[model samples]
Target: MSHSVASPSPKLSSWTHTIGASLEPWINLTRVSRFAGTMLVFWPYAWSLTMTARSANLPVARFFYLLFCGFIGASLSHSAGCVWNDILDRDFDRQVERTKGRPIAAGKISVPSAVAFLWAHLGIMLWMVRDVNSLAFKIALVTMFPLAGLYPLMKRITYWPQAWLGISMNAGVLMAWAFITGSIPASAFVLMGGTWAWTIWYDTIYACQDKKDDVKAGVKSTALLFGNSIKLVLALFASLMMSALVVVGRLNGHDLPYFLLSVVGGSIYLAVQLYAVDTDSPKSCWAAFHRNGFNLGALIWAGFLADYIWAAQGPALVDFARGVAVGW
Candidate 1:
């Protein structure tokens, strides 16, 4: 008996191509494939969850579950925000070299389609957080309007659009804090401020990538606002962020490792990024901006995780490790 291989049907191939073509623009609009922004949005939520879990003595399994949900919520919401920004800024985007090829700017996707896509993501985000605390839900609802509605317009009217973006991005910190504690605490506000400052620092670097384009397009940004003082302004923000982190750790009673990793380590990582950044070079600015997600964010999360483990497991583990070291 002879066996023959069957070829793919033309109908199936056509269907696949059509689906891919339709989905590509939506994906590009959302920037879902580029995870730096998503991770940046998620980190503060993760930090809040870990801190709250430690304070509330929540079960480790429950902490992990909430963390997973936070990640999903952050990613979805960030993508939705990106779509909204693109929809509103399509005209300005077309005028900017860096953004000219964006889905809406390039005419690969229409405004109405992008709006529909935005709502779809927003719907999913609402569903994901439906079971969270009422306060978290309410805060999330309020955040969506300003972030998705107002952030895009900031660039048109203010040089501090990065500040608006910072506020938009760091809203998750408040949401996550409320989700875990059922109320926003003073420490949460402090963390929010810290996150806001950090956003200003990194996003200023990011905005530097399009400063010339922004000038030509009549757009405003902190990058152009700071101009020669950009590095000084970034340093100030970074210092403020580090100081706020220290205050947060003290407020939450995080141990020495928390300070070591999240404060000192994160500052060192940020310092390296700052030292290497060249405001005039788009490549340097982009690299420094993206590096914040992995470097500072990871260090802070690691500190929180370490503190959580030590708190949950007690001093017996620490003593046992010390005893082992002595024996060795």
Candidate 2:
């Protein structure tokens, strides 16, 4: 008797189930806050602010080319990094209450599958920026290395991992500026540095929510490490963030009004953060962390608005799109 070879069925049901299981926890939606935090870290707002500094006489074609490309690339990098971070931290995540239900941590995605997905996301980021300057490309590559590798381990050993996280997040700002201008100026460095510090301060507040679980799991974090002093720590960092912003304004030769208005807005926001912050309360920590998004948007707007005010009607708002297109 000859045995007939059997062909495999499509297994559509199994495939659909598998995909649904894998995607459901990722769609938790509360995670969107984390993603937003990641996006802000890329400082796309800062890039837009810098574009406002470009001369109006510059060709619109090049400005928009740079603007669109820079914005999209930074966004992709931000998303890819966030996804990859979730993947890498999956194992450790299960040990923490807040993260235990995440898709990867819950075994909805197997470790190998999560790893492949991370690489794929990062690959997309690479392809997105392929046409950028060689120097910028190299910087981007180096920047992502830490995100995929060392960043996950940071919580294992340091209370200040948020500092490194900020560096990774701000790397896009530096790379984009260099890609457009072909050189790293003191102004870009200073502004990006300020943005980085701002990220650290805010992310620390975020980490505060997980402090108890993190300590139980033997993970180091600013929240867990600071313990009873987290409020004071937050105040210190917030003050430093404002000081850095003031330095940025001075470095850019912004007028006193620019500094006063921006700093006043920032101070008011910071005061709000300080007044209601409660390190031991996870709900309060989440609220405080989300407030940073507003701060990020406000700070960027402050800088851009100041530039507009000082530049005498600011390069014809109608030409904004055209100017961005041509590298103004």
Candidate 3:
């Protein structure tokens, strides 16, 4: 619809080709340069881990180890998902203005190349989780297939592909809880639901950026479906997301920090997002999407981390502080 019809990508500039072109396609294929998407994937794991670790009375050292592992797992899952999505959507991407030059879409790499790259990520993911509990390992494997693997095709048939993504993208909540606790209690599902709504809200804002190009390219998204009422619909989802967080906080008996920062701060942040983002402008939409990954996400995670750290190690920390004062 924009520029040339779907075709092989042209060569990079002379110096770029000689310098980084060899690895550029692989790099672009996984979107490693774009950290926001990876952060989106990691936040769910962080929120879930810190919240659950408090209840488990996990040691500080062990909690951090698990948190680090969650980040690596999130990176692998997100990178793999991006490769698979690119492989499936290359044809559709070539016609979309915003995505035409993506590695697979622009034909910088073959589908087989992308597929192989995908397996490399998955192989690493499997190895990374080999020591995790059996249930956690199985749950992680399940996310690899239909949950995430089938996502790109959802746009071909449904206007609410973001709904599918809401579930797939935040699945780390379940996997991480299972990894740490060997079980997914009702609260895990409750928190996952909140993260799911959160994904839908932000991703719909993201979809707004491509509304025109997507229509021309015959792609369906909530942006097109919600049309003039996109703001209202997103607001509703945001409210639901905030409500779920509050509900999860109650069920888990989270301290004041969580109720104040995660629930209150998160709601205020969403209100700012609602008031600020203009879906009609691509730059505005992209900025709002970035805030979901960086700003709003951090507030929520910080609340959980603060509560967990205080609850799990507050006494020990106080004693150490007293010892240091005496030594001084």
Cα TM-score per model: 0.93, 0.79, 0.90
lDDT of 3 by residue, 97-147 (tens): 889999888888998878888888888887887888999988887787878
- Rank candidates, lDDT, best first: 3, 1, 2
Per-residue accuracy of model 2 over 225-292 as CA lDDT, tens digit each: 67787778777877776776677666656665556666667777787878888877889878777667
**lDDT tens readout by residue for model 1, 46-135:** 988888888889899999988888888888888988888888788999998889999999999878888887888888887887888889
Please, what's the RMSD in Å of model 1? Answer: 2.4
Flag the better candidate by lDDT, 1 or 2: 1
Worst 10-residue lDDT window, candidate 1: 140-149
Which consecutive 10 residues in model 2 have the weakest lDDT in total? Answer: 49-58
Clashing pairs in 3: none
lDDT, candidate 1, residue 274? 85
Using TM-score as the measure, which candidate wins?
A: 1
Stretches > 4 Å off in candidate 1:
1-15, 322-328
TM-score (C-alpha) between model 1 and the true structure: 0.93
